[model samples]
Each structure stands twice: as structure tokens, then as C-alpha cells.
Target: MDDNLKKLIPFALKYKPNIIWNVVFNVLYALFSSLGFVMIIPVMNVLFGEEEKVTKLPTYNGIWELKTYLNDTLYYYVNYLTEQKGAAYALYLIISIIIIIFLLKNLFGFLGLQHLMKLKTGVLRDFREKMYAKIVDLPVSYYSEKRKGDVMARILGDVNEVQNSFFAVLELIVKEPLTIIITLGIMFSISWKLTLFVFIFIPISGLIISKIGKSLKSQSARAQQENGYMISVVEETLTGLKVVKGYNAETYFKNLFTASVNRLYILTNKIGKKHNLASPMSEFLGIATIAVLLIYGGTLVLQDGSLSGGAFIGYIGMAYNILTPAKAISKASYQVKNGSAAAERVFEIIETPNVIRDTEKSIAINSFNDKIQLKNITFSYDGEQNVLKNFSLDIPKGKTVALVGQSGSGKSTIANLLMRFYDVENGTITLNGTNIKDIQLFALREQLGLVTQDSIMFNGSIADNVRIGKLNATDEDVIAALKIANAYEFVQHLPDGINTNIGDGGGKLSGGQKQRISIARAVLKNPPIMVLDEATSALDTESERLVQDALEKMMQNRTSVVIAHRLSTIQKADVIVVMNRGEIAEQGTHDELLAKNGTYAKLVSLQSFES
Candidate 1:
């Protein structure tokens, strides 16, 4: 088995009950199918009256003579029935028995299929769930390097590809080989000489089929990669549709999208062209091998006269039966290769280790005390260039220590490191006196609330979005939080109040409304610490006034780290720290900073001039 294909074994074992029962039914189906062919000779014999006449009942025989004994016994009954009743009666009985055998064959085949459906769908279902669960826990840093659409494609398209090719390979591997083996055993019984001749071509056909699919996995990998890239482009275009339209870059994106799809089209065509060969090559080989067998077996029947005519015809039919499974196995070989490519991609995401996971000795904290401190932290998003360099600060309890800096000055990185969104390269962030990494991640997060510039929202009601902070918060709690954030008046005017659908990312609401709702969410949680990253920078003057008012109310008596792009928002902060490059250039109270007449004083001047 390919290494990637082996990953499926654990998931397959998850449905062990399904596998065991499916194999049982498949074994029965294979038995009845071969037996159906075996009965063909007797049917032809009874129909043509070529059954050997027996004078008396055949004697009981050992297992070695079972075939001859059974044949004699069957002929004796037929002769007796023909003499007593009629030839038509004996013929009807033989035909009816053949029908029953075939019926049982089909019945078991269907039963096997029922269990197969469960195994296929069950494995894929668990696999998709597992991928989604893992993706959710992956550190936020992982998303920075990956495209949204590519991740979405892995969960959706690649999983579906596994369903089509990999799970279907399961059935082909089990049932097809069993059918071929049983049918070959029957053929050998009629004439070992002819079955030996048939065996000569089996490996040859397998070789041709294997050779056809040798490079399919690589080609398929390229195709799926291109497909993921195309999806990433589509995702980027949708996410930045406003910018794309405002800048009139529709043609640029469309042309870029078309180029990716065109590459995918060519790669898939290469795979399909190679994949298409397996069926025709195996089919032609099957018929050609059969033709050679017919002549060899015909010569034996006519000149050698060792094999009976009825048995010869039946053997030929069995040979043809082998062809069906041979064809299926041949095709499946290619599909397994193709599916292996998708499996590799799926497992890539599943096997990635999360760098931000909690340690074995981690402890949960219920409340925060004293202060949160970042001590001599050095960090970088990209490994080569530092984003924060020995950057240290102290945020005391109930104090709003605001971060004021230009873009890329590491203000937001400080917030991220404090919240454990990204761990610092060389320092400790402690909640109270304990290292935040030593605390249970969920517990650490529970003690803090974050409101980012984007105002992330799910497609749910106003109350539902707020409940994300505290899942059990009642409608009254939601309303109280909203009122504290100065958002309840507008929410009350809506048709459904707090129950109204927010739409995607609260598209139905204005920028200020979403920001206030986010503040209300943090207020409802009532965490000991809050981190607000440019929470009102994107708003108009009026919207900023409303959102800023909400932020102030939410931060009351709570330890807060506010990263402010607009210096005006942080003029009253307990302390304002101005960042330069990756380090803190200065830190003091607003009055003390103004007295220094340095970076903080200049930032105030710039904002005043812009206003």
C-alpha cells in the first residue's frame, strides 16, 4: 500500500462492524456468483438430453469423488423423473434452480453494497469533521500563511475526491479480487490445462494496467494544487470585492482566475488521458486472451475429447465473468493512485502540529489580579525580521494602558502576544504572576476579551453574537450589555430587537453598530482584562464618537490594552506608550508625555492637524 493510502486504515477501522459484515456478504456474493456459472453446464445437459443415463442410485462416495458422485446422482434423478413424469418437468426444475442461485447472488451483492455505503459515507463524515476540528484549533499564525479558499478546498473538494476514488477502492479491493479468485477456481475444475493457459495473461494485463497509472498520482497532485489555487483567487476576489470594484481591477482578477483554471484544465486533461487508458487496455486484453483460450480449449474438446462440450461452453462463460472483475480492478488501480494524491493533501492539514497548544502541566485560572506584564519579549511573524524586539510593558489592574503608534510599530503584536494569539519568541507574558503559557489556554482566554478593527460577526441574531462571550447570558443580560455599550437604543428599533439576524458579518448594520455590538459582547463577558485593537479607527466622526463611548464604558474598572491608531482616543489613558519600529520609544501618563514633548507630543500634533 502507498504510505498516504495507509492513513485511511485507522478511519476504516472506526467502522469495523461495517467492514466485517460487508466482507461476509461479499464472500457470499462471490460464492453464489461462481456457483451460478457452475450450474450452467447441468442446465445445458438437462435441456439437450445429454445427461448420462444411470441404471441405479449412485453409491455414497468420499470427498475425492464428490464431483463424479454428484453428477451421477443428478442424472439418476433426472432419468427417473423423465420416465415417470416428463422431460419438460426435469428441464423446468433445472432452470428454476439456476434462477434461484442468481437471485441469491444479486441479493448478497446488494447487501454488501448496503454496508459499503455506510463505511464510505461514515469514514468521509468523520474525516471531514476531524479536519474542521483541527483547523479550528490551529494557531492564528497558520492562517496568516494560508489562503482561506485553499483551506476551504481541502475541507470540501479534496474530501469529495477521497470519497469518489479512495472509498470506492475499498470495494474494488475486496469484492473484485474475491470474484476473480472464485471464478478462476471454478475454471480450473473444468480443465486445469485451459485455466493454466488463462493464468499466463493475468499478470500481463496487471502489468499494463499498473504501467498506465504509474504517474497518475503526481499528475493528480498538480491538478488538485491548481484547483486549490483557483479557489484561493476566488476567495480573495470576494473578500476584497469593494477594493476590486473601487479600483476597477475586475479584468486583472478575471484574467488571473482564468489563467489558474486553464492550468488546472490542462493538468486534469493529462490525468484523464492517462486514466482513460486503464479501461480500454484491460478490456482489449480480456477479449484477446479469451479468444486465444477459445481456440486452445476448442482443440482439446474436438480432438482430445477429454472435456465435454457442455463443460467447455460453461468454462468459457466463467472466463468472461473473470473479465468483469479484472476490468474493475484495473480501473481501481488508477483511481487509488488518483485518490492517494487527495489523501496526501487531506492528511497534510490533519498532521500539522499546533504550535500554540497547552502543555501537560497547564493549570486553569478563574480570575486575574495585580497586572498582565510582557517582559523583554522578542518576536517576529516572519522568522527573519523582528516585529517586536525586547518590547516590555506593564498594564496594572483597572488601568487602561493604551498603545499609540503608526502602522507596523508592533502595537497590535503586543495585544496578540498578551492574548496568546502568537507566542513571543523570547519572553514571558504573565497573568498576575503565573506565565500565561502555563495556564490552560481556554481558561486564559476566558479571563480576557478582544475586539478587533474588523468587528468579526457570524450570521446569527444580535443576542446570539453576544452570547459568544458568555454562552448562558439571558436576553436581559444582552440588553443590559448593549445599553452599557450605548447600542441598545438602535437594537431596540430593529424589528426583532436582539433576536434579529445580523446577516453576514453584520452587513445590515453600519460600521459603528458592529463595533458597538463587539464592545457589548466584551461587556457581557465581563472579563478581568480587555484588549481593543483600533476599535474605532475605521469609523466616521459620529460613528467614532458612539463607538468610543461604548469602549470607555466597557473598559471601566477593567485592565485594558488599547492599540489606538487615532491618538485622540487614548489622550486620557492611564499611560500612553508610543512605539517606534519594534520597541517602546516612550511611556508616560498623557500629561507627563506632553511635558516630555517627544514622540507622543508629535503624534497629538499630527492628529490635531488632520482633524
Candidate 2:
């Protein structure tokens, strides 16, 4: 509880101005409500013929003297009206005062709610936006170990719960205390004895409420984690629905989803039961307090006639007011427990160290020159084993290099490292004599283009998809890029041409057409460097040939790094690097490698039979 409270203080402090306004309105509302209860005294005295004539009104001489003086002045005015216009006019004045207090109470209540909502929603928006930015800015290695849906759930669902439930607790922070204080003050003025009794039971109720909420934090955390798992299931199913159907794994996935949801159901029920206990238990305690107050106050009145009927009734009213805020405080205790679990999850992502960040004084390069050098580079996805060890490579300003290797042999790792997707653990990778780490990532990436085997496309028009590579590219430039990538012919034949809307992930397009569009996108980028990672491996022969032609044209006069499984594809490469178990086993042109009769030779022989 202390830890959760500590976490909330920072978020609360972030929106202090809104919190201050909310607190101001809440305090004012509570004060007005209690004052309305106190006003009943003078009006009732006039009605019952127990009115006292006063030459001088009440006065105060110590701490809280101003508050006491105000209460006295209010009572005196009511007395004056009672004397001037009889009991009926005083009754009307009391009714009018009650109406005014009620109005002010509701008005301030609305203002408090408005400010609370503003702060709640504002924090929610900012938190989500910052989380999203962090997610985008984070190194790719982070996502390799994390579920996409889990991240999504944290950003959307869990964050929302924190905003709603956490701020709901905060609303009580101001309202409940103010209500308890004002009501206690009024009750004490009426009869200090009864107010003291009320205070005694409050701690006992608080202790019980706190005990009930003890397990709520762990339960809420489990619920949020299960929610992430459920979302992951949904995301996986959507992304791989075709594979699921093709492999006849629908029932298996359905059962998995059902089990996850069932666990979520059980956890939700647990959380709900814990949350629901707050209202009823608090209500029961309140009833017990009220019953005790009645017995004690009744004994006092019956024994000595010390407590007046009006005063006793008003005191009970104040006690009743205490119940609402007390219940709220208890409920907020539960809510804060729940929100604390979510806040921890949310803050974890927001506070994750950005392992990849630009140097403070890094300068941006306008163009690539000289050569890209990888000198004695070593890297590892996990710290235990190196994926690339003592690796060295150099590509001149305007040449093509193809890296071919078996699975997990550091083919794709080269592409990843070259793009600075993950920084190397040891040694230097430099472009034009400048270390890649020392350059601004955006500027460095802007100078390079990547096209992977799995072509990615959003749901948008062809023109929009192409323009994504370079936002400022003109329509003419897009069309020219499409032509260069051999995509314009099919695109022009579509019913809407460039305006045709591709479905999600380009589901509307054939695999071959998607590859063409991807090539078109790369061509549109016109970056000085291009990285092609088995870009044509997924295509049919005809499509591969067309895309290869487009790629060749795009590669012209550019520093290109190619990863290919087909040895025939890199037959014309200026350099071919064949990796075996994180180290280069063979290097040279296709013929030179085949003549070596080594790993590259065996790979070419195996692929020749498969092709």
C-alpha cells in the first residue's frame, strides 16, 4: 500500500493545478453541505418557541476563531429574521438558505468533477502518447522478447484502467477528508461527546477496509497480465489466420483462447469480489456507528435533557453525511490497490532505458561517401553466445555485396547491425570513416532503404503506400518509381489504378503484386544505401525475375547489401560472404566459392537440386 501510494504521488503531482482546483471545489462543497445542516438549528428554535433573545451575538477568541465567528454571524442573522418576521418568515429563510447551500454544493461538485475528468483524461492521453513514442523509439531487440499484444494491452487497456480507477481514488483524496472534517466539526459543535464516539469507530472501519484490500493489488496485477495474454492470442490469430486454417489448428487455438479467457474470468471475479466488499462492509460499519450514536445520545437526552431534538436530529444528519465519504474512502482504497498494479506495469514500459539513443553532439550527414567498414565486429542477441564474432567486411561507395549463410549463421544479423537496429557488443561499424553509433539514427536510417522477404503494406491506396518511402515524393516520382520496379503495368490495369485501396497488409493484392509494390516503395526511397534481405525469396519465378530486375536497377550507383538463399542470384556480386556458425566460412564470387568446394559450394549444390 505504501509503495502504491508512493507511485501515485508522482502522477498526482504532475497535474497539481487540476488537483488543486478539484480539491478547492470539493472542500467548498463539503463545507457548504455541513453549513446547511448547521443552519437548521436557528430555524427550528423559532418554530418550537425556544428562541433566545440576544443583545450580543456569539464571539470567538482563539484558533479557528474566524470559522467560529462566521457560524455565529449566520446563526444571528437567522435569529434576527425570526424576530422581525415571525416563525413563518424564518422557516422561509431557512428553506431559502438550504436551497442556496444545496445549489452551491452541487455547483462546486460539478466543477470538481469537471476538473477531475480533465486531469484524468489529460494524464491518460499523455501517458499513452509517451508510451507509444517509447515503444517506437525502443531498440528492436526489445520487441523480439516481448509480445506485441502485451505491449498493446499495456498502452490501451491497462493504462485506461489506471486513469479511470486511479483518478477515481484521487477524487476521494480531497472529497472524503473534507467531508469527514466538516461533518466532524459540525457534529462536535452540536455535541462533542457524540463526535468523539464517531471518531473512535473510524479507525476500526479503516483497519477492516485495509485488510480486505490487501490481496487486491496482486489480484489486479494478475488480471492485467491475463488481459495481455488474451490480447496476444487475438493478435496472433489475426496475423496467422491463414496458417491456422491451412494447418487445421483452429480447434487447438480456440481451446487455448478459451482457457486464457476462463482464467481471466476467474481473476476478474476475484477482483470484483474484493472490490464489491468495500461498499457493503463500510455500509454495515456505518450502520453500527449510527446505532451506537443513537443509544448513547438517547441515554444522555433521557437522563438529563441535555441534547435538543433539533440538535440531535441535525447531528444525526451530519453523521449520515459522514457515511457517504467514508464509503467513498473505502472504495477508493480498493481502487487505488487495483490501479497500483496497473501503474507499475505502465511505468515499467515508460521508464525502460532507451539503449539506443543519439549522442548529444552527433552531427547529421547529408550523404554517404567512402566505404562501409565492419572491423573485428562482435554481437549477440543474448549475452551468453556471440552471433557475430571478429567479423570484418568492407563495401566501397557504389558496389553490391551479398551475404549467404545457413539459418542462424548471421546473414540477417548483418542487415540488422548495418541498419543499427541493434548495436554491436564489440568493435566498430563505420560508414565513410564515421562510427555508426556516433551518427544520429534518423539521419543514418534515412540514408538507407530496406526491403525484406515478407513485404509489408498498410491498407491504403497504391500511391499512398509508395509515398510512405519518401513523404515528399511527387506523383510523377511515384509513377516513375513504380515503372522502375516493374509495378506500373499491373497497377495501371487495376480498376482504380494508383487510387486502388489495398486491404489490410495488402490482403487485396496477390503475393507477386505485393512484392512489386514493395520494390516500388524501395525505389521511391532512392536512399544511397539499400539492404535486400531475401526480398524475392517468397515470389514465384516470374515475379522474382521481375522484382530482381527492378532491384538491380534500384541498386545501380548505390551501396547495396543483399542476403540471399539462392546462390544463382548473387552470381554477379562484387563480393559474396558465406557465414557458418557466426563466422565467415567462404567468400568470393559464385564461381570462386563453388571452386573452393566448401560451405558455399555445398549450399549451391543443395539449392540447385531444390530449385
| lDDT scores of the candidates, listed in order | 0.87, 0.85
Candidate 1: pairs in clash? none
The residue-by-residue lDDT of candidate 1 on 1-611, one tens digit each, is 67887888898898999899899998999888988888888767767667678869998779888877887887888788878788888878777888999999999999998998998899889989999999999999999999888899889998888777766677686888899899998788789999986798899998878787888999988888888899999988987888999999999999999999899989988988877887888889989988988999899889998877778888988998898888888877888887889989999999999989899999998888788888999999999899999878888899999998889999888888888889988988998899998999999999989989888888999999988889999999999999887889899999999999989778788888888888889889998889999988667888788778877877888888999988888877998899999899999888898889899888888877332
Q: Which TM-score value belongs to model 1?
A: 0.96
Which candidate should be chosen as best, given lDDT against the real structure? 1
TM-score of each model, in listed order: 0.96, 0.94
Per-residue lDDT of candidate 2, residues 1-611 (tens digit): 44644565665677889999998999998899888777776666666665555536877777668766765676677678777886688788788988898899999999999988888878777777878999999999989999999999999988887776777666666788888898897798779999888888899999999888888989999999999999999999999999999999999999989999999999999889988889999989988999999999887767867887667777877888888889988888788887788888888888899888897977799899899999998999989889999999999889999999988998999999988899989999999899999999999998899988788999999999999898999889999999998889899999999989999999999988888888889888989999999888878888778878888877888899999987667777889999988898878987787788888878878877322
- Which 10-residue span in candidate 2 carries the lowest summed lDDT? 1-10
lDDT of 2: 0.85
Quote the lDDT for 124 in model 1.
88
Error of 2 at 519 (Å): 1.8
Stretches of candidate 2 exceeding 4 Å from the true structure: 1-16, 55-80, 594-598, 609-611
